[model samples]
Target: MRKHCCTPGQTTRTPSGTKRPSVTGSFPADPILPEMVSLAGGEFLMGSAEPHAYPLDGEGPVRTESVPPYAVAATTVTVAQFDLFVTATGYLTDAERFGDSLVFEAALPHDARAHPRVAETPWWAIVGGADWRHPAGPDAEVDAVRDLADHPVVHVSRTDAEAFCRWSGTALPSEAQWEFASRGGLSQQPYPWGYERDPGGEARMNIWRGEFPGAVSTPTGKTFTAPARSYPPNGFGLFNTTGNVWEWTTGVFDQRRRDHRAVIRGGSHLCHESYCRRYRTSARSGTTPDSSSGHIGFRVITAK
Candidate 1:
C-alpha cells in the first residue's frame, strides 16, 4: 500500500506542472472556493509525537510520512460558492434533501430553545431546517448574514462537497495532501504557524471560545459561524484551515488507518479542549461520505 487516501472514479494528476487555472466566471461566482490556493505537494511529516497521545479518539502513532507531491485547497468551502454550485448543478445537499440534519443544539440561541442536544457532546440536534443555504435553520436568511462570503459553508455532506468540486473541475484534497498543505511548512506544531499558538493570545482559529456543547456564548459572540478569513493564514499561506469547520478530503480512512469513518481534516472552530480536542496538528476524524452535518464542510484542489 502506498499510503493510499484516494478512491476510484475521481481523476488525479500531480500538481508539479505549471498550468494556470482557466477563467471560470465573474464576481457572483468566484472560482467556487476563493479561500483556497492550490499547493504543490512533495513530502512532509505525518502522525503525532506519540501513539494514542491525543485526548481525542482518532489521533495516534508517531510515524514518518512521505506523500507524493499534490495540491490542496487553502481554506474551507464557503456558502456563497456552494450556492453558486447548487444553482448551476441543481444539486441538493444531504441536509436540505434529508429534511433535517445534526446541529450543536446549545449552539442555537437560548431564546430559541427546542430540545436537549444529542449525547456525544450534548450539543448536536437534529434540526429540520438546517442546511447549507440556511445554516441557522429554516426561515434563516443568508442576506442578513453579512461578510460571511468567505466563511466555510456548513451542513454539507461529503457528497455535497464532492458534487460541487466535480462540477467545478476540481476534487477534494487527499488525507496526505490535506495534512501536508495544512502543515504550511511548519514541521511539528499543532497549528500551522507553530506550537506557540495565536500571537498575542487571540483565538488562532474560529473554534468555540468558552465551552463545548453546554456553552456557546463567547466574548466574541462566538456562538455560530464567523467570517472565513476571520483569523489569519498559517505558515503556508492557508487561512481558516484549523478552526472554522472540519474539512472533507478525498481519502478513505479505514483502509489506510484504523478509523471507522471517512477522513476529514483541519479541525473546525467548533473544536474545544474539553470537548472535541481535534484542533491539534495530528488529529483526524471520519464520517460517511453521504452523511451531512453542520460541523462539516470542505475545500478544493486542482493539478497545476
Candidate 2:
C-alpha cells in the first residue's frame, strides 16, 4: 500500500510541468444544463462581529462589499454533473493524481485503519485511494450512497473545481458573491433562512444534529450529506448554502499565509456549534489549493 503524509497546515503539491490529462469525451453546449438563479447583486456587509466569532479566522471587522449582478447555480455541482465534466475533459482530479485524499473518520470503512491522522484535526484521516470516486476509502464507492449523483461532489480540490468551471464557461464565486447569495437577501443574518438556526423546531439545513465527531441526532435521519434541494431553498432559491458542504471561493483566505489557501464558505454536515460553528453565511475557513476532502465542494457563477 502507498503511504502519503502532510502536516495539518500543509498540502501535497503537484509538481510543475505535469501534462494535462487527455480528453476522452465532450459535453454538448447546453445553455440550460445547470439551472442558474439570477441575483440582482448589491452592497452588503461582509464578515462578522459576533462575540462568538473565531478571531483567528478573521471573520470580524465587518465591511461593506459590493457584487455586480450575476447568475449562480441553484445548487452545488453534483456528482453526476462533475462526472460529465470528467467525461468530457478526461481530467484527473488532484485526489486521483495524488493517490489519496482526506476522509472523515466517521465515514471510514469499518476495518480501514493504518492511515495518517492530521495532528491538529484528528477527525481527518489521509486514506490512500480516497478520492471523488472512492470518498470513504478504497472499499467504498460513491454509487453506494443512494441519490449520490445529485449530492454535492466532495473530495474535490480548488484546482479540480476551476477546471470544471473553465469547461462550463463559468467561474467560482468570490467570497463576497458567495456570502451575498448565501444570505438569501437577508442582511447580517446568522443563517440563510433567518436568525434562528432551526426555525419552527425543525432542521432547515444539513449539519451535525447532535454530538460532534460521535453521536448524530439529526431529525432528518441523515448522518452525512443530503441530496441537493433536500432542504428548503433560501430566499434567493439557492439550496444548501449554509450546510451540506463547504463551497470554495476565489477570495484569498489569509493574505499573510504563503500556502495559497482560498476561502471556503458555509460548512459541512460535520459542523457543530460546539465545535466548528462555521455553518453560517459569515463563517469562513482556509484550505490549500491542492487539498481535497470529503467536506469540501464548490458552486459556479456567471456574470450577468
Write one digit per residue (lDDT tens) for candidate 2, span 177-282. Answer: 9999999999888899988898889888888777766755543343277777778999999999988888989988789877767788888887777767888989
Write one digit per residue (lDDT tens) for candidate 1, span 1-304: 1211111111111223333232243324455546446565665667776532353433555557766555665666677776676666566666665666666655555555574444434456556667776665664444313535566787777877767776777778777677777888878677777775566887677766664444565333533666666777777777877766788887666675554467777676567665555666667776666666666778787767
Runs in model 2 deviating more than 4 A are 1-10, 13-18, 22-32, 141-147, 216-223
Per-candidate TM equals 0.80, 0.90
Clashing pairs in 2: none
TM-score of candidate 2 to 2 decimals? 0.90
C-alpha lDDT values of all predictions: 0.62, 0.79
Error of 1 at 256 (Å): 9.6
lDDT of 2 at 26: 35
- Candidate 1 wrong stretches, greater than 4 Å: 1-38, 50-52, 55-58, 109-112, 115-117, 139-147, 218-223, 256-260
Name the best candidate (by lDDT).
2
What's model 1's lDDT at 10? 14
